[model samples]
Structures are given as structure tokens and as C-alpha cells.
Target: MSQERRNFDKEFKLMTVELSKSRESIQELAKELGIRAELIYRWRPEYLEKPEGSFTGHGKPRHTPEEAEIARLKKQLRDVEMERDILKKGHQHLLQGRREIYRFIACQSSRFPVDKMCEVLKVSRSGYYSSLKGTVSKRAKENQELLSLIKQEHKKSRQRYGSPRISQALRANQVQVSRPRVARLMKQAQIKARMVKRFRVSTDSK
Candidate 1:
């Protein structure tokens, strides 16, 4: 009885070629992968020369020029659509702070690729990954505590107090905080003081 010949897919061939570049011994890699060393040696040059067109199995038809052009256009369309979706969902965050942008990316990470989101949002990939670790600095913790207090005081005043009044009110309670910092936090939290209309005892002349 004759033994059937083994067949390798394009992915496997490409992976083998990539492994061959980093590996010290092609023979060792081939032995581990259960293939002949000559296969890696043959795949390397072909992959290096035309990576996209390489290792299209023996019977498979090669892509025509029109097909290749269509493939390229389809890729471009997909990329454009991805960017449009990202922007449509995350446009508001773009106008806000970097932390807000990071939060948006983290929230939308399930829908889109993190690296692509980072690229589209103009934020560093390392920063986005670091945000994933959920590390809050001492100052940030302090600010959060201060913001809580500010919210309480603002509500107590019935939204009639701005940052300066809030700062004075905080100090009266023995909480040492700056007005500018209060203003910034208020801006971030969208806390605004309501304007009071004063009554004037004046009659209109007819």
C-alpha cells in the first residue's frame, strides 16, 4: 500500500517561515513541527519575495489583477467604515479630556480593536494599556474624595453655589481645598450655579 502525501496550508507555511527567521536551527524547528527542514528553507525565500502571493496551494487559483484590486478596495472600505463607527460613537469624548477618551476606548474595546481605537483617537497605545490596569494615583484619589464633598455641598446649596463659594464652604468645614481646583472639578462634573433673578420695584411709564 502507498502512503498519502501530506499537505500544508498557507497559514502553516507562513508561520513556519516566520519561526524559521527567529529560530537558531531550522532542523530543530522542522523536527518539532514534524516536517522536513527543506520545507522551511524553500518557504523562506518565497515568503520573503512575495508574502501575500506565497504558498497558494497547488490546485488553488491565483487571484486575478481585478480580484486583487477589488480586495484592496474592500480593505479600504472596511477601514473607512471602522473609523466612521469609532468616531460616531466616541466623538463626544474627543472634545473632553484624555482620561475621558481613555474611558471611551475602554468601554468600546469590545466593539473594536484596542490598537485601532488608540490610533484613531490619537492616544498612545501604552497609555490605553496602562489605563486597563486601573491604577489611580494618590492625587487622583484625593481629588475624588474632594469631588464627593463638593457634590454634597453643591446639592446642599441647591445648585446656587459656584466654585468660589464652594471653596469657602469647604474651608468652613475644615476641608482645605483651592478654588481653582474646585472650579476644574466642577467643570469636569458639569456642576453649575443657577442664576437668581432679582426683583425691581419699578413701574413702566405709559
Candidate 2:
């Protein structure tokens, strides 16, 4: 048979499944449609001889327990990794947003104009105000106060102690808080105090 005929036969098998499954015989349908019975008979055997596990796109796939578990674990792992990346990005965005906010405020009150700052920062006033609502409560104020104490200690220990070291210093002073929180406050204050500019010392003995 030609490839085209074979493909047509497969489609004919699919289209004729319901009619084939009915009680009426292929010979009866051939007589009713005035066509050859051989065409129907040829495909009928192919349909009957189909493997038990084969599907015709009518229902959900049946999976083994291990396969299902493996799929579920893979999806869960993907979701968790996505969440971690989102958290990291959010932290970085928050820090950058804080810097922009500081510049905005500084411009409005100091040398830079608010409108000019807005243009330079490439952020709208609404977004700037929204970030201002980072925390709002007495507890939040207390957290800021605790953060200031940590900063004081951090400065005393070493001006360049990043959030992690500041968190350690907080622990040593009996102030309990997470490193993430320390990092947040440091970001908010924009206090990256230790800033040593790198330069190659030219010790050429000429």
C-alpha cells in the first residue's frame, strides 16, 4: 500500500472506532454505504489487534506511583528554586530601591530637585512612596532601634562588617535577630561604611 493509503487507513480506523464497536457488522455498513466490505474488514483486525496499553487521546494517562512521585518531586524542586531566586532578586531590588529613594529625598530637600531626581532614578513617585511603607508599627520602630544598636556594634567592631558580621555582633551583645533582618536594615540605612578604594601601588625602583 502507498504511504498515503496507510495514513488514511489509520485515520479511517480512528474515525470508524465507534461504528466498529457497535453491534452492526462491517458487511452491513458496506452494503448500506454501497462500498467494499474488504476496506472495513482490513482495518477492523488492525483495531482489534491493538496493544492493551495503547490510548486514543480520550482520557488521562495512567502513571505508576514512582513515575508520579518523580514528576511531583521535579515540579516541587522547580518551584522551590524559583522561590529562592525571587527572594534573592527581591532583596537586591529592595536595596536598589532604597538608594533611589534616598536620592529622591535628598534631591527634593537638598541640592537635587525632586522632579530631576525622579527622572534620574527612573522611578515614579508612587513607587517611591510605596517603598516607604516597608514596615509600619511600634514593633517595626523597635526593630529599627535594634538595627541601630547592631550598626553601632558593627561600627565599633569594624566599620566594614557586612550584615552577616553585624548579625554576629548583635548575637554577642544579646540582641536577637536574623541575618536577613540585619541585611535589610543596613540596606535601608545605606550604610556600607567600609569603602576602601583599590589601587595598584607602583613600587618601581627607577
On residues 94-119, what C-alpha lDDT tens digit does candidate 2 reach at each position?
45655445444543445444444444
Which parts of model 1 have CA positions greater than 4 angstroms off?
Answer: 1-60, 137-180, 187-206
TM-score of each: 0.48, 0.30
Residue 185 of candidate 2: its Cα lDDT?
Answer: 79
Clash pairs, model 1 backbone: none
For model 1, what is the error of residue 122's alpha carbon versus the real structure, in angstroms, after optimal superposition?
A: 1.6
lDDT of all the models against the reference?
0.89, 0.62
lDDT of 1 by residue, 24-81 (tens): 9999999999998987888888777677787786514367799899999999999999
Pairs of residues clashing in candidate 2: 107-112
Clashes of 2: 1
Q: Residue 60 CA error for candidate 2 (Å)?
A: 59
